[model samples]
Target: MVDEASKDGLNALAQAAKQAPRDSPRDSTRRGLPPVHLWNPDHCGEIDIVIRRDGVWMHEGSPIARKELVRLFSTVLRKDPDGYHLVTPVEKLRIRVDDLPFRAVSLGREGDDLIFVTDVGDEVRAGPDDPIMVQTDPITGEPAPRIHVRRDLWARIARPVFYELVEMAEEVDGQLVVRSGGQAFPLGAVA
Candidate 1:
């Protein structure tokens, strides 16, 4: 459980994230992504922020309603070996993720490529760089599908979108595979 002081710290971090500039001159010069991967900030400790399975950000048992704040926080999100952390230039704070951090809410197609739009508005094209993977839940035997977004970050494909993928799937080597960017991503075995 998170203490009151930690909750206050999380609030401060959220505030800081909100105030951070999104499209500054320096950012414009960079073609894609802030170098969160290269940043080795000090661990400020874990905060009482959780990203729920349904894509809700919660702090101190309350939902964080500000979409811009959520978007800003998403920008700094990094998933390391230990778990997920919200990283800044100076500090990194651990946050709880019930499942995956982002959810792929919609899908589109550009010729042979499959484009996925995440809840945070990140557009991911599934290919060699970003591949679709589905893991079967051991207990429930359900498929948990995900797509790589950027640099080890992934978005859990929502069920409806997964259904869309199913519609596009074709049999390949007795496996249900979806073709995108001239690559075949196996959704699962034909059952």
Candidate 2:
């Protein structure tokens, strides 16, 4: 498998992506963010987090510095408040708690819609005209939360990222049925 990130030629589009395209009609709702490609030059030195719904995707205007993105996301996950929501182009991610090294993709904007790519390079993309729903970890059963974390002896990290995700997953049923929130979804389905 390719390295998680190997954007060898993605930097070339950074300058062009700096501003929203002049040709398209801007959506009043999007607040004037431009659509960038799968890879953009400006993001080369940045530590960005891609929402991992389908696979890998980037937000239209969320161009933060590399480390800042990690810090912000880390802090949010640590807070782990009830009813917390992380809205991306494709879905809204929310949960009571989350561990780190969480695998995900961003909601990359194409025209008016959003897309996602996974760590292993699978994509989940849908048209902007259509609505998509991704939900937070919901409480399923009354069982005590079970936390399972795998330690890597050789691969050291500041803290294990997957541990947080595992913690969040422990609170729910394996089925994880989420109520549908959009036209593309149906009732009581697993997201």
Candidate 3:
């Protein structure tokens, strides 16, 4: 028959997931390890960034016309870096805010570092050598603390989810496009 606790656990996980973007994960896998946002997915395909307001929107979720949020734009580059230069234009960006939604803090390259400036400055980074982290509940136009992770762990856990989400980010041709890292072994093409 049905297990009540098991059912409840699944429901709780779903409830938490429903509140956030797919693959926009909050992992507590290793204690004392500052959380890394997990995005690994099983399949690899075209992916698009979703701009949802209010709740977790779908693949075809519409952007709320808020200039305070970052709408889909041409990517300067997607990173798979052990090391990256902070001065690259890939870092500089801004997003418009609306009523309520799963927001992203897009930091732009500033001088010798990337500045994660947002209304809720929960997630931010100053440079390449910084940590890739997420902070809960922040204010507008504020800079978040730096997020960091070990490089190998990042590749192992982070990469696959990115492939899946990137696949879902599939409107580049007037939609998103799924792309693999350039140096990926066997070079996973958008499949």
Query: Model-by-model lDDT, in order?
Result: 0.85, 0.28, 0.29
RMSD of each: 3.3, 16.5, 19.0
Ranking by lDDT: 1, 3, 2
- Per-candidate TM equals 0.87, 0.22, 0.20
Task: Residues 1-191, candidate 1: write the lDDT tens digits.
Answer: 55778667767776766554444446432224456787788898887789999999988788888887787788889999999999877779999999899999999999999999999878888898889999987878899999998767889999999999999999998899999977899999898
Q: What is the lDDT of residue 110 in candidate 1?
A: 96
Off by over 4 Å in 1: 1-11, 15-32
lDDT of 2 by residue, 1-191 (tens): 22324333223223223332422445433223333221122212322334333212333324224543433332222111233233222222443212222333333445533343323222333332322323333664322211111111011111122222223232234343211122122112234
Residue lDDT tens for model 3, 35-54? 12243322222222232343
Runs in model 2 with CA error above 4 Å?
1-8, 19-26, 35-185, 189-191
Poorest 10 consecutive residues by lDDT, candidate 2:
148-157
Stretches > 4 Å off in candidate 3 = 1-40, 47-61, 64-116, 125-128, 131-191
Evaluated against the true structure, the overall lDDT of model 3 is 0.29
